[model samples]
Target: MDRFTERDQLIRKWIYAAAATIKESFDDELDIERKSNRNDLVTNMDKAIEKQFIEKIQHFFPGERILGEEGLGDEISLLDGVVWIIDPIDGTLNFVKQQDDFAIMIAIYEDGKGQLGYIYDVMQDKLYSARTGKGAYCNKRLLPTIEDRPLKEGLVAISSALMSKEEGLARTVGRASSGVRLIGSAGIETAHVASGRLIGYLAATLAPWDIAAGKIIAEEVGLIYTKLNGDKVDLLQKTPVLVASPTAHKEIIELLKSQKI
Candidate 1:
């Protein structure tokens, strides 16, 4: 089998294993702590899940390096060789608050290029994945390329942070769209866009793990990804992003002045 095909098979198993762990912890008392502030939290489950993935990836792909949210993986400055970027639980707040709308995600890169990405919506039991030129998928079903939609024709998701801090920004975009949603999880939000359910998504700030898998899958289905300032998103940095259908991207990009972000 080709390299990614072989790795993809095993990666699915790893994601499922992570999901199993997550489901098993729902009834248990969570160990939560704040990162940057009270709003940015991490739990014991997140650390355990990241460690779990590091162990499995090391076992299967011994030489590959991993970059995980919980600092269990290697400390690499660059994506030189095979690297796995993982977010054990994308929406920790949602997981803690509602146990829904969260996801498990992994993105595999080889020599700095995205080879495969996976986003498993734990409660929904839907897996969105993609390989270069192979198209995106939701579980066993293939997703058709997203229709090139404009901002007014469909629902869009803007980060709660952005909606609260930049009401003017929200008003400019919201008045032009059908509606706005507040899905806290970037992976699930991106997957929805990949699935053509949401026309676009924006976030005030996102780490590498947040967008790693979603970027690959969303782009596989023709969603355009870039910074809020119209710059290409750097996969290794934590920055704001605007991911949408081609037309919507153009519309939103133009509506907001360069200094808006």
Candidate 2:
């Protein structure tokens, strides 16, 4: 197998292992702690999950640096070599409360280019993945390109956090669309856009681990991912992001120009 195929198989194995771990320990009492605020919580499982991936990656692909949400991996400054961006649990609040909307995610990059991406929905047991130049898939079934629809003709999602602070902005966008949804998880929301279920997903700010995996999968399926202002996102810092179908992206960009997204 070529390197992409080899690493693709390896990441699938690692993610399956993670799924099993989450299923096994989900009901147990969690050692939860707050980060940044009470709403930003982290559990023991989060740390364990990230630690597990880093260990497996080191054992199988030593010297490959990792940047995990929970800080279990290396302190990466540049994307010089093979780099892995991992989000152990994409929706910690949803995972802690509903246990339904969370996801496990990993994105592999080579010299700053996205090579492989994986997003595993823990409750549904669905895996979405992509290999650069190849197609995207969910449960091994190929996904179609995002429908090129205008904002008014398409369903879409805006971050709840973003909406609350900018209620008028949310209302404006919603009024211009068929409807609005809040998936509470970037990975899952991006998957929806990739599968043509929604035309767009917007977030005011998201970290590298939050957007990396989904960006690869969505972009491969012909969706556009960039900042609200029509700039490419740098997968190394937190920034506002818009993952949308081509038609919707252009429309949303014009609408969001005056706002501080």
Candidate 3:
């Protein structure tokens, strides 16, 4: 097998192993801390999981750079070589409070080009993955390309915070879509869009790790991914994100323009 194939196998194994460890600690007492704000949570499981990934990456792919959410990776100023962008626990609050709805995300990029993406819904046992030029998948089934759906007939997923703060957006999107959902998990929401269950996912503030893997997987299935202003997403900076079907993407852009969002 080629290098990517080998790495894919290794990563699949590691992800499952890590998930097992996390599940085993579900009932254990957790050491949780706040980051940035009280609402932004980080648990011991998040740190430990990131460390596990860092150790595995270092041992298996030495010299590769890792940009992780838990500060267990290198200080990467550039995506110069093989870079692994990881979010050990994407929805920490859900994991801590509900023990579900969170996901483990990892994206492998070669010289800034996304090569592989994995988002494992740990509690649900659903693994969403993608390889460059190879279609995205859920578990063992290959996902179909997203069909363009009109915004009025589609289901859109938006962050609850954004919905509450941006009244104009909430009104416009709610009026346009068949319905709206606030999942509180970027990875889960992105997966829903990629699987064609949701027509779009929009977030006002998202870090690189939040959308890195999702972007790769979403684009593989022909979803248009961009900023709220319909601009290209910068992988290095936190920005507004929109991943949607082509038809809904255009419609949402027009609506945002009308509301100046």
List pairs with backbone clashes in candidate 3.
none
Clashes of each: 0, 0, 0
Off by over 4 Å in 3: none
**Prediction RMSDs, each to the true structure:** 1.1, 1.1, 0.8
Ranking by TM-score: 3, 1, 2
Return the top candidate by TM-score.
Answer: 3
Clash pairs detected, candidate 2: none
lDDT of 1: 0.91
**Residue 54 Cα positional deviation in candidate 3, in Å, after optimal superposition:** 0.4
lDDT of 2 by residue, 190-222 (tens): 988888889899898999999999999998999
- Per-residue CA lDDT of model 1 for 1-261, tens digit only, reads 988889999989989988998999989999999999887899999999999889889998898999999889988789998989999999999999999999999999888888899999999999999998899999999999999978999999999988887888988898899999888999999999999999999898999999889989988999899999889888789999999999999999988774365
Off by over 4 Å in 1: none
Model 3, position 158, has a per-residue lDDT of 91
Q: Quick one: best lDDT, which candidate?
A: 3
Better-scoring candidate (lDDT), 1 or 3: 3
CA lDDT, every prediction?
A: 0.91, 0.90, 0.93
Instruction: Report the backbone clash tally of model 1.
Output: 0
Model 2: lDDT of residue 201: 93
Q: Kindly report which residue pairs in candidate 1 clash with one another.
A: none
